[model samples]
Target chain A: MAMAAFRREGRRLLLSPVSYNSSFAARSAILSYSELGPMGARSISTQAVRNRMKSVKNIQKITKAMKMVAASKLRSVQVRTENSRGFWQPFTALLGDNPSVDVKKNVIVTITSDKGLCGGINSTSVRVSKALYKLTSGPEKETKYVVLGEKGKVQLARDSKNSIEMNITELQKNPLNYTQVSVLADDILKNVEYDALRIIYNKYQSVVSFLPTVSTILSPETVEKESEAGGKLGILDSYEIEGGDTKAEVLQNLAEFQFSCVLFNASLENACSEMGARMSAMDSSSRNAGEMLDRLTLTYNRTRQASITTELIEIISGASALTGFSQSARATDNIQYRRYACMIKLQS
Target chain B: MASTAAAVPFWRAAGMTYISYSNICASLVRGCLKEPHRSEAVAREKVHFTVSKWADGKPEKPSVRSDSPEE
Candidate 1:
């Protein structure tokens, strides 16, 4: 939790939490790297800095790769959603126009993703569901939830287990198509009952912004009531049914179609938003890794130069006592070995 | 308002092709009645049939896993 908190605050903190852990690890590494005392151990600080730099560079590479993948995915999902707009909009006709929602007996469908690290997209929906439940569920009012995505299910299950009508973990596993959602609609229609079905999902407003949005599917009776409530003619009344099947069967199928369409749109929008969040998060992490690398390289060079200058001063002055200079010369040779070792570490 | 929705059974909506459905799953509610009286009659009918549908038991949630995702 602390690590997550640090990551969330990392943008303004302007550093990854790893920087703290890396520096601490490097301190311990310096103690181990310096087998000789400070005077003989010429590469302690430099070796530690080198290790830090390598890890930072590696992180940057990973974040860069993730950012690229997320960018391409975001683009593809955007196209998919745009292309499917024709399919989703027609079904909006099934939305109940009735203002008198049985908020008491509403079936709320919360759409979240199975994955995490994409920001607060999943948590926001869960929070809203909880708030709505707390506010409305009472003696005459009970709101059942159809939770889509593991993240949202886990979040909601922490508090309101009984309120959850169903949880779907696999909807966001792939680029989900209609068939997967069709079965979910069938399940809900075959099982759950409500006067109003409310679908809650994330809406991708822009590259950096997504908001939780709601769409509702009303019962046919509620639709009729809503239409009657409105003094003007209702739009849904125009969708004429002609099949030889019974009126009840037609309405049931229509409800299934509307339910499927709404579910499909919610999942698509949530996925698109999730991809966007990941892209932005990875882009920032990559940039932070670059900055840490710059700092580590600078620290390594300064320490190396300082160590070299101090050694040269000791060697030059020792020339004054040339009688025993041979013994001191051996000490200088150790500096050469240390430099060679440092170079190898740097290469690694 | 769109051609993606098939208003008839077996998706026999005229002029709209199956290709569109496969491409985007865009068509919906094309089979519903436009006349208020037809829907009114259906609304009257759903109350009686709904109980039987519920008695049939809920379709279980499938254990479908997502494709391997990024860490």
Candidate 2:
């Protein structure tokens, strides 16, 4: 312990020209140690060093606790998001194959969580919707809006002078309905004002990533073309008729039902995509917070170690000067110079 | 050696009408089977399916033609 203090004092004295007196005193204490003078004073300084170390350990404990909490929340949110994926894959495939859906004067329905802290999940969607709106040419009358979540409604309402056609903030708690979805579809279908319909939402890409997507609900003519083309997929193969009026009625209903099926399928898929996106965004943010906490703990430990070394050198040098030192001042100065060079190299 | 070849009936191997009509029936069968329980009803012959044509300013007419002399 005395040698460690002597080495530390030699560095300090060489580095700071103003602290020469302190270094001279430390050398004197080392020389006096042989004479067995003032050993009791050195014991008090060692106890103070132990106390400093204990405080540093406490800080490390707090940072580790925060990392654990963030990780736990990430897990639950990821499960909620991933469970809804069963319905998304086939839906997206259907959408991709039928690409003729026009969207010149269509309505966009967006969903976002009401609560924040999922980190940028809500804001990124809002920004994407705003950019989509800006990309439109022609008058505002050409565009219609439907907002699915509270956050989306509030965000769109800020820029929109006209009221939204449908705002479904209550949907988070309740189960979705064909009635509500069909009613919305019927209302849009009634008005031939729009060339096509589109929905904007986030598509979950992974546990920690989501991409903004714009899905098209094709126009009536294009839907007919798709159904006709889909007939090539031979999905409609088992209808048998007894050669009567019952067959006629069934065919008429089948034609209408086919169109409605496509609309319902698209909407269901859009909803699943939104939930998945939310899960991924939250998971990534939780991971990032954990990494930040680790770096902070490391920095806190290093700064603490430096402060302890400084204090030890001060006490050792003060004690050495009080005793009658036999070591020459010239020899102490040479040792001090070499020590400062080593410390400077370590710091750099 | 080939004094005469056996004569086949018009609707038999000598003609193509049967094959073409059967292909249309096959297509119709394929088109209606995708619905849930509709496949069983289709197999039972309880439902009749037809395609109709509507010309300009005309009401409707059956798109298929029959070769029966009685019709």
Candidate 3:
């Protein structure tokens, strides 16, 4: 009967999720104990349990610290992202969006962060860039990528290695600004020959959510051609030229300036999204660690109590056998003791 | 609608390219911002990176470059 009771107890301990962390020796000991009865399983090592708990606690601390850091960074980047919308929105309104117009040569600027542990922000940008490539590329249409930051480059280089024209890294070491972005834009314009520039980035929608967005800016030549072909030049024709500059020159200036503005705003938005994603990812990791710690602690306490009870029973049974006490009385005593232990467990 | 005036921007009259013209405009806007935000924005603009051009599915050597708003 005692052997049956110990076997049942052993089975319950082994079934717990906490047992997954148990070392091979400890698990083998439990298995042998269940088969050989209480005498064998008596030494379920709480030492291994304690070690696992310590490691888990250290991990939780690191994740908690990362969460706090990400939160603080998110605040500053969010402010910059909000303020930068005003810098780019006016230019976007003036130049207008021509989504349906097809351009033969395209430069896709994929924007992402350098460091990771931020969720899917980089992957989303790469995914959207690949989708854009599929939509734009054909025998006649050519699409090239100007990948910014390290994370996107790593992912894009896996499949679309041929399409990548330029790779820029370490852009996130400092905070982003319009002047820096304009220089990058100028370099891109000087290097790549494209009729349209498509920027792919994660747009920060909220603390927990972000959307992959693509904003396209037509080249001045493409704009002029589209306007002439469409024959709806109300907005562009309205602005009068000054300083003896031709309409084409003004359009060229506007296109270049607009690229810098949009690029600046997109980089800021991606930074904000990266921070927010990291904050949430770290938060969930810490929470999961906490939950695991709670379960392991409970199992540890239970194992300690079970081993103590087994020792006590061994002593009592030995004494009763020597002192000529009835087996039935000792069995009853053991049942009562088990009930008391269960009460203590419930209280704890 | 009010009559739109035809006036030349100073940068354009000086024959500056749009990149330099816009950089000056951005710095001016940054200067106009209040207190801590102005300083913060200015600091954020300081960037350094290594750019590498890729050809035939391989990356060439990288060149280190730093860019500041003042330049």
- The candidate scoring highest on TM-score is 3
CAPRI verdict on model 3?
acceptable
Candidate 3 deviant stretches above 4 angstroms: A1-42, A231-234, A327-348, B1-17, B24-45, B67-71
Name the runs in model 1 displaced over 4 angstroms. A1-43, A93-100, A231-250, A320-348, B1-71
Question: What does DockQ come to for candidate 1?
Answer: 0.04
Tens digits of per-residue lDDT, candidate 3, A137-240, equal 88888899999999998999998899889999887777776677777887787779889999999999998999999988988888878777654444677677
lDDT of 2 by residue, A1-348 (tens): 775567566556545643543453465445455544464343212223334445545554554454454456445544544554443345444434333343456566565655444556666666866666666535644656656555666676676636355444443232333333343333334433444455666665554566776655544344444556664323432435554334323332332233234334443443444444444444454455556555554444343334333444454455456432443254355545655664565456
Report interface Cα RMSD per prediction.
Answer: 15.2, 21.9, 6.9
Strongest candidate by lDDT:
3
Model 3 Cα lDDT, one tens digit per residue, B25-71 = 77888899999899977785675776899999888897766965654
* Model 1 C-alpha lDDT per residue in residues A1-348, reported as the tens digit of each score: 654443344232222324533554465466666545654344334555677889899999998998899899999898876666566676654453333355557888888887787878889888877776665577887788878777887787777776777766655544566655654565566457787787888888787998887777776556556666653326545657675754444554555567677777777888898999888988999999998887788677556545554544354345425434554465456545655665677656
Error of 1 at A14 (Å): 40
Please identify which of the two predictions, 2 or 3, would achieve the higher lDDT against the true structure: 3
Q: Summing lDDT over every window of 10 consecutive residues in candidate 1 chain A, give the lowest-scoring window.
A: A8-17
Name the weakest run of 10 consecutive residues (lDDT summed) in model 2 chain A: A41-50
DockQ winner among the candidates?
3
- DockQ values of all predictions: 0.04, 0.01, 0.35
